[model samples]
Target: MSVVDPGSTRGRIVAAGIELLGTEGARALTHRRVDERAGLPQGSTSNHFRSRAALLGGVIDGLVAGELREAEAVHPATAEELVEQLAALVELLTGPMRVTTAARHVLFLEAAHDPALRDRLSRDRRAYVASVVAVLEQLDAADPPAAAEALMALCEGIILHRVARHDETDPRPAIAVAVRGALSAPGDG
Candidate 1:
C-alpha cells in the first residue's frame, strides 16, 4: 500500500511510530511495526526514514509541531482565562491524545542516551516553556519564568498520572487549581 502522496506517507509513518512507541515502548518501534501500524506495505517505512533514529526524530518533530501549533492557537490574558484554556488542554491530554503523552515521555527518557534526540527534545521543551512564560506574563505572575517552569512540570505530571491511571475524563479542576496558585495575587482576585 504505497501512498501516492509522499508527504502524507511520511506523516502516516511517523504517526504509526508514535502509536507503537506509546503502546509498546521503544523496543517495539521497528520499521515493520511502523509499516503495519500505518497500513502501508512492508519496507515502506524504510523508504521514508532510513534508520530508527530518523524515525524517532520524525516522531518527535510531529509531536512538538502539533503542540506548538496548539499553543499558538490559544492565548490567555488572565489567570481565569488560562484555566479555561487548560480545560481543553486537559481534555486533550487525558482523552484521545493519551498515547501521544505516553510516547512523549518514552522519547524523553530515550533522549538521555541519544544526544541528537536530546538536543531536539531540549529545543522543543524550550519553545513550550516560552509559550507558558508568555501566558504567565500576561496574567502578571510574580515570577513568570519560575511560574512557567512549575506549570510545565505540573502539566507533565498530569499526563504521567493520567497515563498510569488510565483515566480519560478531563482533569480541568486540578489544572485550574494549579493555574490559580501559580498566578494568584495577594489582596487581588
Candidate 2:
C-alpha cells in the first residue's frame, strides 16, 4: 500500500473526522476511527489533534466554512426572493447538510464541560453569524444590518427548535415558514 505523506496526514485526519462527524455523529468520532479512515498510523490522529476536543474544533471549522461558502454562493433578487433562497438553504441544511447541524449540536453539548471546546464553538458561531449577516446584506439592498441580526436570530431559533425536537421529523419546512414570516414582518427590526 502507498504511504500517506506526513504533511498531508493532518488534513486527511481532519477530513476524515468531518466525514465521520457527518455520518456517524459526535459519539462515533474517535482518534482511532479517524486514523483508520484516513489510512494513517494510529499516532497520526494524536500527533496532529492532540485531543478529541481539538479534533472536534477542526470538524466544526470545516462545517462553518461550508456553511459560509453555501450562503455566499447564493444571491437573491428581492426580499421574497431572499426568503426563497433561505428556504432552499434550509432544505439543503436539513437534508444533505443535516450531519453538519447534528455535529454542531453535539459539539455544543460537549462544550458544556470543556472550556477549550466551548471557546472554539463560540468563535465558530460568531463567524457563522457574521457570514449570515453578510449574505443578508447582499440579499436585501436596504437596512441589511438589521436584516442580518433578524436572520441570525431566526437561524438560532430554528436550531433550538430542531434540537428540542430531536429529529422526530424534518424541521426545514417549519424553519422555512418561520424565516419567511420573519423576513416579511417589520417588527423584527
Candidate 3:
C-alpha cells in the first residue's frame, strides 16, 4: 500500500472515515466523528468533503486505490495455481485486510440510502468484476464470464463471513474448495 500523507487534511479525513467504518460501522460515519478521529478541528471534514456521500466517496476511492495497488497478476492454467491464488486472496480477505473488508461492507449497506455511494460502488464493482473475468479467461475457463461471476460471488461470501466473525486463522482451505468448484469444468458449478 502507498504511504498516506498525514499532513494531507483530505487524506486524514478519509483515513478516519475508513477507521470509523471498520470500528464503528455506518452509524459512526458522520463528519463529526471523522473530524474527531482525524484530530481535525470541528467541521474540518465537512470543509473537505462537503457531505456524507462525498465523504463516503473518499472512502470508496481509498479502498479502490488499495485494491488496484495490491491486485495480483493472474496467469493460472491449472487447479494448483488457481487454488494458490484463492488461498492468498482468502488470507487477505480474512486477515490483515479485515478492516478494509469491513469498511467496504459498511459502505455497501450505506449505499442503499446514498445515491452517490451507490454510483461510486457501481463503478468500482464493474471494474472488479471485469478484472475477475479477465483472470478466468486467462485460466482458459470454457465460460469465463459465468465462472467469473460465480467466483466473484464466492469471494464476496468469504469476505462477508470473515468480516462477520473476525476470525484470525486463515480460511484458505474452505475458500480454495469453493473457488475450485466454481472454476471446475466451466459452468459446472
lDDT of 2 by residue, 1-189 (tens): 123333487768867886787677677899999999889988888887888867776676666767767777666665556666766776567667776766666677778988888887777667666766666565543555565666766765665565445444454465556545545546644
lDDT of each: 0.80, 0.67, 0.76
Candidate 2 segments exceeding 4 Å error? 1-8, 138-146, 156-189
Q: Each prediction's TM-score against the native?
A: 0.85, 0.72, 0.83
In model 3, the runs with Cα more than 4 Å from the true position are 1-7, 72-77, 167-170, 181-189
Measured with C-alpha atoms, the lDDT of residue 164 in candidate 3 is: 93
Model 1 agreement with the true structure over 1-189: per-residue lDDT tens digits: 122232598888878888898889999999999999999999999998899888887888777776677766659877777877766775676677878878988998899998998988898799888988887887888878888887778777877777888765565677787887788764555
Scored against the true structure, residue 98 in model 2 reaches a CA lDDT of 74
Task: State which candidate has the highest TM-score.
Answer: 1
Candidate 1 vs candidate 2, lDDT winner = 1
Candidate 1 clash pair list: none
lDDT of model 3, residue 71:
52
Query: Rank by TM-score, descending?
Result: 1, 3, 2
Q: Which regions of candidate 1 are displaced past 4 Å?
A: 1-7, 167-170, 185-189
